[model samples]
Structure formats: structure tokens, C-alpha cells
Target: MGVLPLVHALVPNSVGNLGSLLETVLPWAGLAVPFALLAALRRRSASAAVAAGVAAVLWLGAFWPVVAAGAAADEPNLTVVTHNVGAENADPAGTARTLLAAGPDLVALEEITDDALPAYRKALDKALPHSVRIGTVALWSRHPLTDTRRVVLDPGWSRSLRAEVRTPGGTVAVYVVHLPSVRVGLFGFGTAARDRNIQELDRVLAQERQDKVLLLGDLNGSAADRSLAPLVRRLKPVQDAVGGGFGLSWPAAFPLTRLDHVLGRGVVAVESWTLGGTGSDHLPVAARVRV
Candidate 1:
């Protein structure tokens, strides 16, 4: 139990997001750790009780974001949806329709390939008249998009893009990003490239001059994940600020980690939540924010 809190903090999250994964599942320990603490107390194990108490403190501290309350989503300035329409999704059209039916002011997508691009464009063209596709990342908006360009966070590929949305309230800079994926194995977490990609994106965000910015997509990391501190510090995760709970949205069937997120800078998240899967590995994350 004593080692539990230490483990949580010292986790080398950079290795393969091992630390992040640990944090993602840390809440479960809240239940198990106390039970163990009670058993230890009953057994009159002073050391065990102390250790359990430490673990409980650390666990709750790490979990505060999930339970914290914030502004409501009512009367939102903007309603956005971000999804990772899996590259192999069987029904891209269906996913597109489902996303559109949500009536989002903007839709940000990751994992869009050349072949799948046309399908999405065709499906969204009528409803979202303004759209931009730069490599694998795309943004379709009900508002006009201008000054769009690829962000180039990774080498040899495009996984991020930027555009300015002319909304009813004002123009907000929108970043559609698909950060490099991390992996795990005997080799531990493989976040080298992913880390590098994050560094580059971090630099770009640091220089961002926009007053209101919306970051949307499959970041491949959670808001609480240590590896994402740089971005998290600059932006407010909609889910963490207003979500009722974990709001997990990955591995759709048994959604666990929140790999997809909608974060904001200079905006207030009124509401946030994850929707049921739309033939993708990740469930769509939606948020309403006050600009």
C-alpha cells in the first residue's frame, strides 16, 4: 500500500504511456484499496493500515477531476464533436450520418485516409458546407473555414491540421489533431515517436495566438495522463471539467480509456460526454463550450 502512491507518481509515463494507463485505471483502486485497508485494520496491521491510507489519499487526489463540477452545457456558444472514425470502419457513411445527426457546429475526425475521405466529404457536404482535409485529419464545420493548413506534428505524414471557424459568435481557431499512437509490450510503452510528436505539437500550441481555441481529435492520451501535461496545462478538457464520470471512449465495445477528447483554451466547457459507438474503435466525444 505504501508503494502504491509512490508507484502512481513515479510511473515513467513517457515510456509507453504506462504511467497514463496506470492513472486511467487508478480509480478502481479506490474501491479495492479501502477494502484492503479494512481487512488490514481488522488484522491489526498498523503498517498495512498506514500504507492503505496513503494509497487512498493519493488515489482520491488523482481522481478529483472526474468528480469536480463546472459550468453547465446549457446555452453553449459552440457544440463540437470529435471522433476517430477507425481506419477500417465498415460503415464510414453510417458513422458520418450518425455524427451529423448530432447537429454539431463542427466535426473533427482522425484516421481519415484518401479512400475514406471522399465518402466522408460526400456524406457531410450538404449539411456542413465548409470543410477542410489535410492529410489524415479533417474538420467539417457548419461555419466557414479559412486559413487552413497542415500542422505537421509527425514526420513523413500529416496527423494534425489548423483552421479558423467563422462562428456566429466569433472566429475561433480549431486544431484537428491525431497524435501518434502509443503501444505496449515486453519492450514496455513505445511512445518515443508519440512523445516527439507531442513535443512538436506542444511547441505549436505554445505559440498559438488565438483568443479562443478548440482542440479536437483522437489525442491517443487522456487529460489526466502525465504525458499530456503540456497540452492539458494550456487547455481545459471539457470532459474533466464537466463530465459526470470517467467518460471513457475507447475500445468502443468495452470502452475504457478516454483516448478522444475535446479541449479548450479561453473558453468554458458547459457540457461534455461520450456517445455510443458509431462503427469505430472510439466513441465520439462531444462538448458544448462558452466562448
Candidate 2:
């Protein structure tokens, strides 16, 4: 039982959503290890000692940064936020208004369809003067936007885009994305599409030469999810550096996970937080960064 948590962490998950789901509750599972060991020791079990040692290594190995705080930065150069506005968002207008109210230097929205684009544009026109979209994702900026184009991530459609925003500090490359969603059941957390998308996105990011780059939108996975390691290896999540608890942003009513994120490369995080619930299922995430 004690080695179970460590086994899950080290071994690749083959079952549906097994590994990913385990990540969501791994902390709690680890928390149980010590108590379980205590009970075993009280029973004078020698195996308890060995299990205790294994649990310690597993907990530390997987969550050391979380307990210690990650590489968050200070004194930001700009602020940005991201959200995956559910397609059926009951109140798109209200969600748009709520997001603009945060006054981030930039905002990225995902899961936006052609039909709802107008409402978002109208609601944000006055606040976000410059905006662009590719497929279902879009970016609004306060600075000059240039070199905007579609990033052909998947076949027959574009779920991502890139734009160069000339901020007061310097030129920053911004990529707005809504990676493919994962499915459960017999398919077993089908992530082939999302993984392929990440590979392409990582390639673009790797080739990018900008001093600072920001990836804002719904990644459909958490920073700890192994499938996202390709991007995580290249970019550091701002909230990781600037801690505020788990900062989960999905399912606004009772967020249990952080599918939305503000990731940065080269820049530094000043602070990060989740906004109050909007009409969308996702709670908006904001971050301040120094480019």
C-alpha cells in the first residue's frame, strides 16, 4: 500500500485517464502514506519501515517543487490571462466584460466559435483595441500587434495562432491555443490529437527567437500532466513561480483542476491568481510578468 503511490508516479499509465486522474489526487494519496505507515509501525511490522522510506522518496520526488514553491518571478513587465469560455457559456457578454475588467495587458480566449465571435468583439472593442483570431482561439492586446498568422496545428483546421505584440518593453511573441480535449471511457484518455498538437506547438516555440514568449489559453491538461511535458520543458508556468495554492481554473463552480494556464519563456512572473467565476465553465487565470 505504501509503495502504491510511488508505483503510480513512476510507471506509465495504460488504462483510461488512470495516470492523469491519479495526478489530480496524488497529493491526497501521498498524504495517506504516512498515516498508513504509522498504523503499520504500531503493529510492529518491519515492512512498515521499508514502505515508509519508499513513500518519503516518492512524495518528495513528485512534489518537492509544489511544497517548496517553483521558479516564480517578481516585478512583472506586463500582465496576461487565459480562459476557455465554454461554447455554451450562458452569458458570453458577461464573461467578456468580467475578463476585460481585470485590465490585463493581454487576454486570450479559447473554445470561441464563429457564431459567438461577434459578441466577444463587441463587448471587448473599447477595452481591447487590437484583436485577432485563428480558428476557435483569439488574442486581444493593448500593444501593437504584428506578424499575425494562423498556426496550422491540426489537419483541416487551425486551433492555434501566433502574433508579435510590441509592448513598451520589447517585442513579445504570443501564442493563443486550445489544445484538443481528452476523452474518457474505453478510449482511455485519448490524447493522440492533443499530443500531436503539442509537438507542433513545441516546434514553433523552439524555433522562436523572441526574448520573451507567452502561451495563454486552455491546454486541456495541468502543468504536472506528463503528456504536456513537451511544452512544460520549454516554458515555465507563471503560477508555479508565483504560488497561490493550486490555482485551479476549470469548472468555475467547483474547480478541481487547472486546465487553463499562463506560461512564459524568458520572462519572469510577478504574481498570479484566478478571477471570480464568470459565465464560462473555466475561471479566468491572470499573471503578471517581466519580459
Candidate 3:
């Protein structure tokens, strides 16, 4: 029991990497191997078999609901848009125009450059009305903003921000984050920065008091990866709720994994989908949720 909490706390920071492993084999690791060993050891003992069965059920039950709930499609909604415009993007104006055309109630952008801000601001100013920008991440909304501040993902990197938007339904706290990218080299995968970002995000989520929350940005890892488990444990992806497949959003030419996402809490996702190719490396992901 003591170790369980420790493991749970560490899970999110490792979720991005673990997701693929879990989806492919981890679920069966516990039930198949351990239960099999117990069965063989106990032989035909009815008591041992029952105990093993109970344990298997309990273990599966704990994670099944979370996975299943994310898979379900529910109604009522808030339209949200998330995108990574790439610091050296080709055309900020065109990208911003495309996003505005989608009619998102709230927009979160990552990898924004100082030079590109003006173009984006001009493109979205009229439609969005209220906005907040902190370093490379920004949030724009149609509703009034109460509080906006930078969320530190790393000691020196100010690539995340949190904003409180007052809407008709209620005040919703939205966090826009851009985590450090992990790279695979001859040596291996570099995950130090990514891991630290996840830990910081976890800390922020834990302290958040708003009942309704939305997390958006370039997480630099997939939902299936274990490194994102911490955030996954607390939030539900819009894609998981309404997307058709993986909802790939990276590399406009050929997207295989979804790196951009919109996660919600105390909100219902009605529909979610990826938008057309943008000038940036990542395609825009949008979701309509019932607040």
C-alpha cells in the first residue's frame, strides 16, 4: 500500500513512454503471468483459483474504467483549439487565419515566436477579443480573462501559462503548455526535459481549484506513452472522447502520432477532429465540449 501511492505519483511523469507498452502488453503482464503462476502452483485448489480470479478482476477494474471512460462519446460542449505553430513557421498570418476560421471558443498555441505574435494578434484580435501570452505559449478566448500567469515547466523555461476565463457557464482555468521534445539518438532516447515538464504539470494540476479545466499544447509525447500518465490520470483527451482514430497531428505531410491535444475536466466533449495542414509542422486539433 505504501508503495502504491509512490508508484501512482510517478506514473504520470512516465506515462508517455508507458502508454505504448501498456496498450500492447502491460495489461496482460499482471493477469496472465502472475495468475498463471499462481494457478499452476495451487493446481486444482478451488480457494487459490478464486483468490487469483478476484485479484485479477480488481486490478483490471481499477484501470479499465479510466480507459473506457475516455473512449466513450458524451454530449454538450465547448469548442477548443490547440496547435503548435513552430517557432520558424512559414506563415503565421495564414496559420492564424485558418485557426480562426474553425471558430474555436478558446485557442491555445505553442512554439509562438516574438516576431510571429503580431501577425497572429492581428489575425485573431477581432474574433478572440481577450488573450494572454507568456513566452512561446498563448491563449485566446471570446470570454473575459480574470487571471493569467506563466506556469513554470522548468526553472529556466517559461513555456507554459494558466489563464482563468470567465464565461456564461462559469470560470474555466485553461493551461497552455509546450513541453521539451525528446530525441532519439545513437545512444538512446533523451527524456530528461520531457520528464521534468510532466512532473511540473502534475504539480500544477494537483493545486488547481477550478472544477472546469482545459489543458492544451504540444506535449512532445503521445497519450499512449507512459511519460504522460500523470496528466492522463487526471484529465480526459478530447480525441479519446470523439476522435475516430489516433488523430495524428504532427508533420503535416505524414502524421502518425498525435502530439497536440486538448484535455478537459468537468466538461463533456461532443466532437473532436484535426484540421487541415498548417504552415507549421503540427496540424491543428479542435474539440467541441459541453461545459
Candidate 4:
């Protein structure tokens, strides 16, 4: 487990996408260190102690940077937030209020239903007048939004969109997405559907003409996972620039892994953090970017 991070790609997933499964919860593998230490102390063997120390060093070497603080020299020009306001959330209006409290320049929402759409529009109308919604995903901006259109993803339905925000600094291309959720049941890691959607989005991103781009939403895959290698290679995660200490934002009640994210290209993230939970099961994530 300690060496999993270094050789996750080599692990096979042919049976049940085991490789992806391991990568998704890789951070938790560090628990082995403590267990090993306890065993070494109880046994009082020099070799066991050495083995425990080695595991600790290996685990920290790979994940310590995420816990350590990071800083940016540039000041921020834009603040963006993303949230998957569960389809069954009882308080849509209250959720909007939670997002508004962040005072973001742009906001992205997923899992929106027609019945609750009015509540969101009315609540965010005054602050973010410029907006666009395609299917369940929506983008609301403080500045004018133009060149708005749906980006084809998930043949079953539309859950992704692209828009250019006319900010004071310049026009920034933004994508709001909610990839298909993967399931773990009798079958092994069920990620075929989610992976297909990710590949389609990757193609859209590759053809993006804009120099500066930001993607906000619940990707349903961690940046550390190899399944997101395409996006990880093209874009930098906000948490990497501004430390948020794991930046986990899923299962709002007790988040164990990060599924929501703010990723950017040709922009600097000065601040990144997760907000308190609202009516949704997933917590909202916010980032201040230097445009």
C-alpha cells in the first residue's frame, strides 16, 4: 500500500477497474504506517522497526506536499465556486444563499431540476444577472456571459456546458460539468460510463481555442487518480497552488475523498478552499484566481 502511489498505473483493473479504485482512495493507505509501527513496538524487532519507518517515509514523500501550505505571488482578480446541489435537496433557496455568501464572481451548479430551477434563478438574479443553463448544469457570472453553448457529453443526456465570461481582466472560457457517477456493487469498480464521459470532455478541452480556461464542477474522480490523467496533464488543480489540506468535498457529512474540483489553465490560483455544507450531499468548493 505504501508504494501504491508510485506504481498505481501498473496495477491491473481488468477485473473491476481495480487500478482506478486504488487510486481513488490512495490517501487512506497511509494507515498501514501506524499499524506497522504498533506491531514493531510490540514485537521489539529492529527489522520490523526499520520496515515501519520505511513505510512512513514512502507515504509522506508522496502526499506530504498536499498537506503543506502553498502560496501565490500574484493577487486574485476572480472568485469562482462550484457545487452539486443534490437533485433532492429540500432547501434550494437556502443553498443559493450559502453560495452567495461567498461573493463569487462566477458560480457553477450541477444536478439542477426544473422544479427547483426557479428558486436558484430568483436567489442569484440580483448578484449574477448574466447566466446560462444547458440541461442540469448552469453557469452564473458577475460579468456578462457570451458565446454560451452546450458541449456534447454523455450521450444519454446533456450535463456539460461552455461559456466565455467577460470579466474586467479579460474573456475567460469556463466549463461547467457533472460527469456520470460511478457505482461499486456486485461488479467491480463500475467506471466505464464515467470514463467515457471524461474522454469526450477531454476531446472538447483539447480543441478549446481560448488561452485561459477554468473547469468547475463535480468531476466524480480525484485529480490523483490515473483516470483523470488527461485533465491532470492539461490543467493544474487550484488546491495545488493554494493549500486547502486535502481539499475533500464529497459526501458533505463526512468527506473521505475529494470529488469536486477547480482546475485551470493559463491562470494562477491564489486561494482555494471548501465551504460548509448546505442542503446538498457534496460541499461547495471555491477558488480565487489571478486572471
Per-candidate TM vs. native? Answer: 0.88, 0.85, 0.76, 0.96
What does the lDDT read for residue 274 in candidate 4? Answer: 89
Writing each residue's lDDT as its tens digit, candidate 3 over 22-113 gives 33223333445365546646697767666666556655554453334345455544678999998889899999888988888899999999
Q: Write the per-residue lDDT of candidate 4 for residues 1-291, one digit (tens) a residue.
A: 666667788988887888888888888888888888888899998898898888888888888878787757889999999999999999999999999999999999999999999999999989999999999999999999999999888767889999999888888999999998988878899988889888988999999999999999999988887788898788899987677488888789998788999999989889888888999999999999988
- lDDT of model number 3: 0.78
Off by over 4 Å in 1: 1-7, 13-18, 34-58, 68-74
Give the poorly placed runs of model 3, Cα more than 4 Å off.
1-77
Full-model lDDT, candidate 4: 0.89
Query: In candidate 2, which residue ranges exceed 4 Å CA deviation?
Result: 1-8, 14-17, 28-64, 67-73
Which candidate's TM-score is highest? 4
TM-score, cand. 4 vs. native:
0.96
Against the unseen true structure, what C-alpha lDDT does each candidate score?
0.83, 0.81, 0.78, 0.89
What does candidate 2's lDDT look like per residue over 1-291, in tens digits? 434445666656676657776664455566667886787789988897677777778776665655555555356678897888888887888888888878888989998988888898998877779999888899988888999999878876677889999998889999998989876667667777787888988888889888788999898888877778889999998777766466888778988778898888888777888998987888999888888
Please identify which of the two predictions, 3 or 4, would achieve the higher TM-score against the true structure.
4
Model 4 misses residue 83 by how many Å? 0.3
Q: Point out the higher-scoring one by TM-score: 2 or 4.
A: 4
Q: Which candidate is the best by lDDT?
A: 4
